[model samples]
Target: MSRAPGQFTVVAPGRVNLIGEHTDYNDGFVLPQAIERGLRIAVCRRPGSRALLASDRGGPPLDIDLGAPLLAGRTDWGRYVAGVVAGFQRLGWTIPGFEARITADLPSGGGLSSSAALEVGIATVVETLAGQALDPVAKALLCQHAEHEFAGVPCGIMDQFAVTLARRDHALFIDCRSREVAHVPLGTEVAVLVIDSGVKHALGDGGYAARRRDCETAARLLGRKALRDVSSIEWPSLEHRLREQEGRRARHVITENDRVLAFKAAAEAGDWPAAGRLMRASHASLRDDFEVSCRELDLICDAVGRLDGVFGCRMTGGGFGGCAVALVDGPRASSIEALARTACAAALGHAPEVFLTTGVPGARVE
Candidate 1:
C-alpha cells in the first residue's frame, strides 16, 4: 500500500469574479464562482516539530520553524505558504511537522485566485490533520490571513472566501464586509469560457497596491469606510465632492456595484443578455477607470466582443493582462475558442489557454 502516514488531501478550487472587480478590497459585494481548475495539496503529519512546504513547480520547497516569525522565503510564494502555518498558530493549534505537496491547474497570473487556492488548500489539510474542521466562513478568514500576513498584500476576503464557501454549479453572492453568502444557480444553456493570456499578476506589484490606496483615498474623501457604504442614490452627489481624486477610479467601483445588483436579478430571471451586457460594461469600467486591463486584456476582450455568438466578454481578475471571461451559446463556443486562440496569437504572439468552467465544491479529497 502507498504510505498513508496519517495523510490527507485537500483540493480548493480557483475563483473567477463574474462581475465584481476591485470592489472587493473596498468591502464591496462580489459574485465569484469556484471553477474547475484549482490547487491540490497532499498534507501528512510527521513526528518532527518542523513544517515542510514543497511544490513541484520547478521551485524550492520551504522548510520553516513553526513557532517563529514568518519571514521572507527563498521564493515569493513561500510567504503564502508560511502565512498558512502562522495562521494556524494564531488559532492555538499545536502544529507538529507536516509535509505538503502542492499543485494547481490554474495559471499563476491568470487572475483566477491561485494564491488563494494555495492558502485554503493548506488550511484544509492542516485542519484535517489536527482533527478539526473549519466552518467555511472560518476557512475563508484563515486563507485571508495568509494573504494579508504572509503574502503581505492588503486583499479583500472575496477570492479566498468565495472559493472556500461556494457550491459547485452555483455562484456565490458575497457581501464583502458581512461575509454573508447566497448560492445562485448558473445558467445551464449558456457556458462560461476563461481565456488566459499567460500573463502573470503579483498584487504586491505596485499596480495592485496603488489601487488599494485609491480605494482608501475614495473612502476618506467620501467620509465612509468603503465604497460599499455609499448609498446607491447618494453616490453621484458624493462624487461631486471629491474633485481632487480621479473620476475613473471612483466611477468603476460605484458602477460595478450597480452592475452586481443588476446581474443578480438578471441571473435569477434567466436573463443571460442582461448579465452578459453588464459584464461588458464592467470590463469597460475596469479599462477606462481602474486602468488595470493591459493591451493583451483589451485585445482578447475586443476580439470576443465582435463574435456573434458570444453574449459578452470582459477581463477578469485584477486586470493587467490576466484572463477574460466569455459567455457563449452552446452551439457556437467551439468556433469562438478557435478565433480567440488565433486572435490572441496574432495580436500578442501567444496562444491563449481557454477553460470551460463550472463551479465545484469548496474542499475535497482526491
Candidate 2:
C-alpha cells in the first residue's frame, strides 16, 4: 500500500490472560500475553481538525471533531479512537486532523481485548505522527483511562499493559499495584491454544461492574486499601466478616493474586504441569467465586482439559463468555485441536473457532 508523506501504519495485538482475571482493578498481579491477532490501522494527517475513521468491518464512517473539548463520538468503536485522541490532547500534544482505516482479526467481545488494541493502536498512530513516543507505562495508562472515561467499562490495566509492553515469546507479568513488570519466557516447545465459545460478553453490561463493587465492599469491610492489601494469610481470618457474595469476591481476588505469582514461578522454571494445574484452579475460582464463567466456556475447558498432550485448559478472559486458552505440547497441537472440535461440537451442537498463537511484540508502527 502506498502512503502519503506523513502516513504510517500501526498494529496492536490483543491479549489473553494466562492466569489472572479481574484482579487488575484491585491492584493485584496478572499474567497475560499479546496474541498474533489484533488491529491494524493505516493513517495519515489531514488538513482539517477532524478525524475521519473507517473500519473494514462494515460500520458507518465516524467523523470526529478533534477541536471539541469533549471528543466522545457517537459509535461504540469511535469512542475508543476519540478517547485516544483526547488522551494525547491531555498530554499537551497538538493533534491535527487525521484519516485512518482499521482492519482487525481480533474477535471483539471474546474477552481478548480488541478494545485495548484499538485504543493503543490509535495512540501509537498519534505518537508516530508527532515523531515522539510516550513512555510505555504512561502510554498504557492513557489507553486505560480512555476505556474508563469514554468506553465506561472501568477496566483494570492488564489488557492495556499486555497490548503495550508484551515481548515476543514471553508473557508479561504485571504487579498492578507497583507497576513492576517482568517478561516470562514461553518457549517454542508448547503451543497456546485459544478456543472462542461464540458467546459474546460486554463488560459494560453491569456484571463486571458488580464484581468490582463486591471487591470494593470486601476491601472496605476488611479495612484494607484494596483487595491486594488483603493477603492470603489474612483472608481466612477475614473471609467470614463480609456477606456471602462479598466474601466470595474477596476470596477469588486474594487467591487469584497468589495464583498469578505461582504461575509466573512455574513458567520461569519450565514446569508445564504446574503451570497447567494453576490454570485449571484459576478457572474454577473464576467460575465459583468471581461468577464470570458461562456454560459454553466451562464446556470448552472441560473437553479440552481432558485431551492427551494438553497441559491444562481454562477460560482466559473476563469470563461471562469468550475464549478458553490451553497450553499443550506443540507436536500434538493439531490432533488436540481436532479432537477438541469434535467433542465440543457433539455436546454444544456446534464447533467453536479454535486457533493456536504464540506471544508476540506489543503495539508498534510497522
Q: Can you give the TM-score per candidate against the true fold? A: 0.94, 0.97
Clashing pairs in 1: 292-320
Which residue pairs in model 2 clash with each other?
none
What digit string (tens of lDDT, one per residue) describes model 2 on residues 1-366? 666697888999999999999999999999999999999998989997888999988778989887777555445678888788889888888777889999999888999999999999999988887788999999999999999888888899999999999999999999999999999999877889999999999998989999999999889989989999989997888888999999999999999999999999998998999999999999999999999999999988898888888898999878789999999988888887888888778767798888889999999988
Q: List, residue by residue over 1-366, the lDDT tens digit for candidate 1.
A: 355768777888998889899888888878988899888887878777778878867577777787675654435677887788777787788776788788777798789988888888877777777778777788888888778766667788888887788897888999887778899898676778888977787777778878888878888888888878886688777777665445568778888988998998998998888998999999988988899998888888888777777888899888777799988775666777787677767777777787677778786666
Output the worst ten-in-a-row residue range by lDDT, candidate 1.
67-76
lDDT per model vs. reference:
0.81, 0.90
* Candidate 1 segments whose C-alpha is farther than 4 A from its true place: 1-5, 67-75
Model 2: CA > 4 A from native: 1-4, 71-75
The TM-score between candidate 1 and the true structure equals 0.94
